[model samples]
Each structure stands twice: as C-alpha cells, then as structure tokens.
Target: MSDRWQEMTVFVRVADSGNLSRAARELNLSQPSVSRIIGALEARLGTTLLLRTTRSISLTEAGSLYLERARYLLAEMEEAEQAARGIDSLHGVVRLAMPVLYGTRAVIPALATFLPRHPELRVEIVMSDARQNLIADGVDIAIRLGVGLLDDSAFGARKLAFVERLVVAAPAYLLAFSAPDNPADLARHSCIVQHGLFGRESWRFTHDQTVTSVDVQAKLWINSAPGVLAAAVAGLGIALATRVMAGEELRTGQLIQLLQPYRLDPAEVYAVFPAGPRPSAKVRAVVDHLEVALNTPS
Candidate 1:
C-alpha cells in the first residue's frame, strides 16, 4: 500500500479498535509505530483528530468528519481496483447492523445461498433494535424496521419490504375474553408489549382515512420480540406483532389475528447505509440479496 493509504488504514483501525496496542496488533506494526503514524498524520492535517487518554480514545469533531470521508474514499478506491482487475466476486469483510429478531429469522436465513456464492467474502453482524450511527459504528449496512421519517442528506435508505403488523391473541385467551371489535376496544383487554420500539405506549390503527391510537393495558411487558409472541401463545394477553414474527403461530392456529376491520399502521423495512456516490460491491450484493429475499413471502 501507498504511504497515504497506510496512514488512513492505520488511523481507521486505531479509531475503530479504540486502543493503540490493539490497532498495532491488527496492522502487524509496533505500538510505537502506530503512535508515530497518528502523530505524523495530525501534523500533516495541522489538527488533532483523536483525543487519546489512558483509559479511552475519542474522536474530536474533526476526527468524526474525517473518518466518514475516509471510509467513503477507501471503499471507492477498493471498488475501482476490483473493477480494474475484472473481478466478479469481491473479497472483504462487510459489517452489517440489524435488529436481533430480523437477523435471526430473515436476514441470516435469506443470505444462506448468497453467502456460499461468494467464497472470499466475510460477514460480521451486529444485532440491535435501537437506531445505530452508521459511520461511527463502522457499519456497512443496517436493516431497520420503522415508519418514521428519515434524514435525506445524511444517509441513504432503500425500501426492502412492507412490515405487516397487527394485534393477535391465543385461542384460549379469546375464549375467556372477547376479541376486540375495534381499535378502541383494546383498552378493555390485557396486552403483551415489547420494549424499545413503537407500540409500547399505544398501538395505532387505520380505517379508510381515519387513524385510531389505542392505549393498551399491558399485563405483560417484555423486551424480546419472540417473548412477546410466546406470551400470546401462552394465553397471557393480546400482542402487537409483525406478521413475519407471528407467521408460524398464525399459520398453526396457535395465535388468532384480531382487529381485522382496522388496519394497523404498517412499518416500512429499510436497508439503510451512509450516503455516498455509490455503494461498494459487497454492500450492494448483500442489499440486493436481502431485497429479493425479504420481498419473496415465505
């Protein structure tokens, strides 16, 4: 690699690993050499990018901005090289961020065939339901499920699938408690809720130009999506769940769909990534595979 390329690569590694020794180990360089490279880069830029301390390392304002641009430029250069080499399947680690349940149930399973096709590629997955900082986290692609507005200038997003959500109950539960006739009737029944996403406080439903938000009585509040469905199957209470999450149960008659007359506000699933001129080959491949996999209903 060229001198500038080496500098940027080392800097990024240092920033990501958050330790000089670890970055040195990763780069196969001495710890003192890593420190010198960072120092020299700061001198060349005439500004400090990282503030290093004994306990932790943090990015300065300039460092954060620089890292974003550096990551983009590196990907672009790597893509150019691959194109010049006439390579079809690219080799590199593509770090992905996604929701836990979605990763387990959909994303991972969908990539089974596609992953084997690319023998040189490596995939690392970080799963969480919370919103992630794409650049700061070094995430190449993030699969998100929501209906909220997105910032156009900062990130790029592609619609993957329409998330079908609804209220559901166990056959046994409905035997004891009457099924909800409308959105408003949910307040009279017990509900199972998952934390860290929408519907924790209230569930929204729509019917022909009308929207209804119902405050549910949370008899059981859990953090896991699967746990929420399990609660409903156990006849604990009604659950607000995505059709994908409740597919098997709904099909097997373990859970009964409710509030059919009212339409639940569907969440839009997206493959979100940093805004750039173009996505790298690996990132695009994963996104394309997911787009096809998510759209094909199982």
Candidate 2:
C-alpha cells in the first residue's frame, strides 16, 4: 500500500512537472528510478498513462482520466494525514490568477472583507490577460472571464456570473460625433481597439440570429481593459468593454452604450482550480466569497 501511494505521488508529480527530470529532482529521486517506477506502474495497469518525447511528456486519453482520479486520491490521503495530525485550521498562501482589470474591480474588493476574517490565510494574486499554465505557475485558483472553457478536463470550474460585452463611448463624444447606428457604421468612427487574443481591429456583433464582423479602424490600440475604459471616458474614442469593466462608468453616465440593437457574445465568469478531489479549505473559502461578491449588484 505504501509502495502504491509512492507510485501515485511520483506519477502526479511527473504529470504536473511535464518533465521526468524535473519531477525526479523535486521528489529527490534518481531519474532512472522515477522512470522505472512509472514503467512498472504502466505495465501493471496494462496501459500507457503518458506519452513521452525527447523534450516533453503528455497524458494520453486514459492518462487524463487516471490523472484526475489519482489527484483525488492523493488529496484525500493528504487530508487524512492532516486530520490525523490535528491540523484543521485553514492557513497558508493561495496563489490566484485572473485578468488585471477584473481582479482589480471585482476580486480585490471581494477579498477586502474576506482577508480580514481569515487572518492566518494569505493570498498571492497573479494578474494577467495571457493564459497561465496552472501547474507550471503554481496557481491555486484562477478566475476566468470568457465565452467558454478552453480545456474542461484540466480544471474544475464553477460559474460565477454571466457577463456581456458592450460597445460604449463617452457621452461627450457621442454628442460631438454621430453614434454608430449599426456595426458597419463603426468604420467611420474612431474606435479604441484592444490588441490581444480577442482581436484588435475586428469586432463581432449579433442581431436577430445574424452575426456580423466589422473591420474597425482604431486611432488608439491598448492592451489593457482599464486603459480602454479610461480613454473612452476621456472622450478619446469609442471602445469595446465588458459590462463589469465599465459598470461604474455606465452607472454614473460617464459612458453610454452604443448600437444597443446588436449584442456582442456573452461571456461567462468562472472560478477554476486544479482538477482533484474537493478543493482545500482555503481555496473553497476564497471561491465562495468571490461567488457572492461578484454575483451581487455592483
């Protein structure tokens, strides 16, 4: 049983590390020994769990399923050990990943109340628009705002909110220049483009079950959502923004929604964590707090 547990632990580390040598070094085991243990386990199971290459290793279909179960088992084992040792308190740092603007507007404010209650728990926030490798980056929880999940098997996600993208501009700008009557009219206006994965110059809109793409001309190209909001509020140009990102501006009439007849694709907000057994207490606490805070009226 101890040997089985060791094999499970080693396999998990190898999966997480994505390199046998790195996993071996971290486990304080020889490379050959780690390789042999994995080989032995694969042979015993009569299936290949990982596909190895010269530079990297990846899980097979069977491997992915087995990995999920293995993580659950390991987590349960760890919980059992912690319980036996009487370490019931939730403490230690949880590394969280999220987009910068959303983290600033939604996540940080939520944690203001949450952090005070859990005096022993610390949190490290990784704010970026780029997709982060959860295992490589050691992220404990990730908050994603997007149309859908990129990889469902990799993490367990809980839906926090449904968000919408809005094409908006400062009321002053709209008064100075004619507002776009439709998606195509954006070509004649100065558009603030977000040059990222969502596309810089191309904006998509849907109406009456019809979808259209507009090749927008941008006088300003910004990578950050906050920057886009700031520029729009300053009456520089029109911008595409998420409702949550511009919630305050919209509420205070600093920005007005444009082309209301057409709608951009709605995005879902999710709190994701590594696929395993139930999440640790600290993870659950933060996720729970975010769920309520984000879902509440802004």
> Per-residue lDDT for 223 in model 1?
74
lDDT of 1 by residue, 1-298 (tens): 8878888998887886678887897578999999999999999999999999998889999999988888777877888877885545668888898877767788888989788888889998988876666665667788887657455456777888888887899999999999888888889999898875543668888898798888889888887677787899999999988888788889999999998878887878888776353677788888988999988977
Scanning candidate 1 in windows of ten residues, the lowest lDDT window is: 146-155
Q: Mind giving the per-residue lDDT tens digits that candidate 2 earns over 132-225?
A: 7877665778888766454657577788887789999998899899999999999999989764534458788999999999999899988777
Error of 1 at 173 (Å): 1.5
Question: Which residue pairs collide in model 2, if any?
Answer: none
Model 1, residue 68: C-alpha shift (Å): 4.6
Q: What TM-score against the true fold does each predicted structure earn?
A: 0.86, 0.71
Query: Which candidate should be chosen as best, given TM-score against the real structure?
Result: 1
